[model samples]
Every structure is written in structure tokens, then in C-alpha cells.
Target: MPAFDPCYTLIVLAGGQGSRMGGCDKGMLTLGQQTFAELLVHRLRCSAAAFNPGYGPVLISANRNQQDYGRIGAQVCADLRPDFQGPLAGLEAALSRASPDLPAVIVPCDMPLLPDNLPAGLLRSVMADQRSVAVLHDGHRRQHLCLALWPQSALFSIRQRLDENQRSVAGWLAGQLVADVTFSEESVGALPFACNINRTSDLAQLPG
Candidate 1:
């Protein structure tokens, strides 16, 4: 793979308890027509194809309803460890489920209006910076928790962090060789991406 190539296995992270949403399946929540995870998968697949049109599989890191997520036309896996330990657990599952050599792009299932250039921009930083992970820096904030790309080389450090009870994704990231790819309205097509629907009422926060 070339250093700047835009090819990667995509991981749609939906393995949360959705405690704020009253234990609902956030990924299965319908926004307009399709569910959140479904919409994200569709948009990402379309955008990636338009960007490079290459071969890369999509993986879903879902804790429950494995069958439901499987229907999305992608491989699905649960957290390697127990509980919804956050995106890091989901990410570990994603890494294990994907081809060993290919790096994977991780995106939360709730961000329906994600940037089209997310994978490319992050992957570019991954290669250029030679870092274990490269994540989105949304101009004013580093969106480090859920959106990013990681290579298999990161598995050891990740496993170590999780084993030591270091569950915070941002906290674990601070200890690794990471890159922050900046994004602005002019660059990413949206400012700060989209607000995650933490509650059912949050649907109103979506664009009209």
C-alpha cells in the first residue's frame, strides 16, 4: 500500500449501551429513512468509492443485535472484552475482525452527517505522520474518541491500556504516536461534523 493511498477497512462503531437514550439501540434509530448506522455505512461506502473506488471491507462493531447489523451487508463483531467499555473495545473488535494487514477507519454510528473526506484525511496523516493512529481535529476540538484510523501495530498498546483499566479513548490516545488532522467547514464540508444523538429529543438537533 502506498503511503498516501486512501484504502482502508471501515469500522462502524455501534457497540454502546445508549444509557442516555434509555437503553435504546442508537444504531437502529431511524433518522429520515434508514437507521443511523445504516445511513453512515451507505454514505461512507459511497464517499469512499467516489474518492478511490478501491476494495476494502466494512465491519460493524455492535454489542447486540448481531443479526440486525449483519443485515447491513457488512461483517459484525462484538467487543473482545466484556461490557460496553467504549469505542476502544469496539475498535479492538474491529481490528480483530478485519484483515490483519489492513488498517481500519473507525466511525461512530450516531454521526449521520460525517465528513466525506474523513477516511482519506485521517489515513493521509496515518501514513505521513507514521503514527499508530490519526484522528479528526474539528478546527476547535480534537474529535479523538470515535473517529479515527488505526493500524494493527496499535493492538498491543491498546490491549495494554484496556487491561490496565484505562478505558478512556482520548486518554489512551495520549500515550500513543498519534496525528491530529484538522477539519474546518471549508475543508470537511461540515463544521464539527454532526452532533451525536444522545437522546431521542436530539433528533430535533438534526438539520432541516
Candidate 2:
């Protein structure tokens, strides 16, 4: 596989209300030796370095604890609409701040075991299919927020969707040319690719 360009932006979606996790900031939750945000940013840095020199800094979409998230050395941004307009709002916020011409790989901070191949695999699929988006469909379902790549051009459509009060990420993607990349258990080895920690119990299930 050809090395992916190092210019792609990494948008970490951490702006959720965390209702399922008892109103806690899932991104700030500790997993093993690092916080969810720290671990993700670190893993992505190493993963990107393997294919190229390095990737861009982590642009975290955070509604609260902006100062804490920023302390992790990531550029923290928040949704323009208040009271948690959902992931779409976070996506818009991060995309607007990203380089307008480059594509961005979006992931949720709660999914600590996101595949190392996510960014490169999605990029390749989108390029090969000439689509505007690429996202992981983990066998049974579309893990839209778990992992997805979006071209900067989609920013306009997203903004329009928000204006129309459509907050569903799936609804937004339904209108786009999406390349659905599948990551089977066999393909990901022991790693539970796209698995997320939505509750405190889910955290106990994390791989050691």
C-alpha cells in the first residue's frame, strides 16, 4: 500500500453528552495507562508515522473541559450550537477549523481500539471509488461515527443539514457517495476494531 499523505486532519469527536456513561466525559475516562483522548492521539501518531512522516495534530471536538482537552496538546473545538446538538455539530465545528482542501478522518474518542488501518484504508477506498466519503461497516452495521473519512467539500452540505435541524450522522451520509469498508474480526485480529465504551461496564471489557 502506498503511504497516505501526512496532511489529512484527524477529528476526534469528544463532544457527546455522555448520557449513557452517567454524564461523564468518556474521552477523559482512563483506559489502562492513558486517558481515552491521550491514548487515541498517541496511537494515531504512531500509526500515521508508520505509513508516512507524521499526520496532522489531533483536532478534538469537545463541548466541555476544553482546557483539559487542550492540555493534551490537541486543538480543542466546540459545537457552534449549544446544549449538545450531537455528533454532527461536533463534526461541523472540527471541519470548519480544519484545512479546507484536505480530507479528515473522524473518530469518536470513546473507541480506544480503533484500527490502525482506519485512516489509510478509508482514504484508499474513497479514492478508488471516487466517492466523497469512506466509513467502516463492521460486518453487521455501519459504524458511522466510530470511523469515517470526509472531504472538506462536504462541509457545506453538513452545515445545510444542521440548518435544517437534521442531526443524524447516518442521514447526512445517506446523501453522500460513501465507500463502506468492512473490518471483520478475522481482518482485525484480536483487536476489537470500532468497539466503544458507552457505559462504565463497557470499560471493563476493554482488552488489556
Candidate 3:
């Protein structure tokens, strides 16, 4: 609903070690017709068009299968610190590799059911008063650090956090001026923008 700059890079977070998912790259897991990373990019592209038809290309943050992720036709980047630093590090890597000309939208590859209007809505909040960050809050909780839109200004601050080893995504976000947009608890029978497949059982349950 909020107007925003159409040009922005989408950063798909897939660099985690996936400790809960048996130490495998969750993004490589298949659901429906393709891998999670591939499917995420597809859905994001479709969703982004509703907000900005000129939305910049997508980038995937992964520690493994860079070539495979790259095969998805997205710029593939890895975490700055190779010790599995978590999603914040993935976000940091994305910023480091992204062009400074546009803001970056960050989403997790595990979340295949992200809402269509999310990127646009978050962009509107950040672009409105020129805030550095904007995040989402489902009726139950704040998705916080991951599902958000950030301006070019966040690069340095994020770099600083990484420099000082501040790897807590929530902590870093707590220190910044962030705006929150709430969404309905669910859409139909599913959690809109919140269906993250984190376990083997989850992957097995994906809708056909």
C-alpha cells in the first residue's frame, strides 16, 4: 500500500547450517516442482511484480552449493564468516555483495509461502520516512530480522555488527529504527508469509 523505490535486490537467506534439519542445506530440499531456493525465487519474483515491476534481480545467500544456487539465475553469495554465523551473517553477505544503488529485501529460503504483498508493504514503510529498516509482525509474533526491507544505509551498520561479532539478528534489529507491519494470523488454512519448512516432516508435508 505504501509507495517505494521499485529498484531493490532480493536476498534469499540460505546460509545457515540447518542444524535442526539434519545439517543439510535446507534450500536444496525439493518441494512441489523445484528446490526451495528455486521455488523461493520464483514466488518472490511473482510477488515483487505486484509491488514494483522493476524490482532488481534476486541474490541467494548460501554456504554450500554456490554453483547450484547460482544456477537459479540469482547472484549467489556466502556468509562473511565461514563458521555458520546464522541469518544475520547471510544478510551481511548479501549487503556486501549487493549493488549500493538499491535497497535489499531479505527473506528466508525455507519460507515458501511468504505473502505476495510483503515486499511492497515493507518497502513502503522504509521508504516513507526513509527508515533504515522495516520488519514484519504476524498476529502472533514479530518475524523480526529476517523478513524485512533495508535501505542502503544499513550496510555499514551491519558490517560494524559483524566486525564486533554481534551475530544476534534480534539484537542488531533492536538497536535500529525499525517499523513493523502486521498481517492477518492466517490465510485460508495456512499462515500467510510464515510457512517455513524446518524439518524433514515439514518438507514431506508440502502441498503438491
lDDT of each: 0.75, 0.78, 0.75
- Give the TM-scores of the predictions, in the order they appear: 0.86, 0.88, 0.87
Instruction: Please identify model 1 stretches exceeding 4 Å from their true place.
Output: 1-5, 46-54, 186-192
Q: What does candidate 2's lDDT look like per residue over 1-208, in tens digits?
A: 7667445677889999899978999999986778888878777643554455435656899998999999887789999888899999999999888876556778899888876667776677655553468878888788888544554567889999999999999999899887788876632333466777887777877766
Instruction: Give per-residue lDDT, candidate 1, residue 132.
Output: 60
Ranking by TM-score: 2, 3, 1
Between 1 and 2, whose lDDT is larger?
2
Clashing pairs in 2: none
Q: Find the candidate with the highest TM-score and give its number.
A: 2
- List model 1 lDDT by residue over 1-208, tens digit each: 5534456788898999999988987899886778888888877753444545456778898989889999987889899887678888888778877776666778888787776667777776665554568877767677665454555677777788889988888888888877777777542232236456777767666654
lDDT computed for candidate 3:
0.75
Query: What TM-score quantifies how close candidate 3 is to the native fold?
Result: 0.87
Best by lDDT: 2
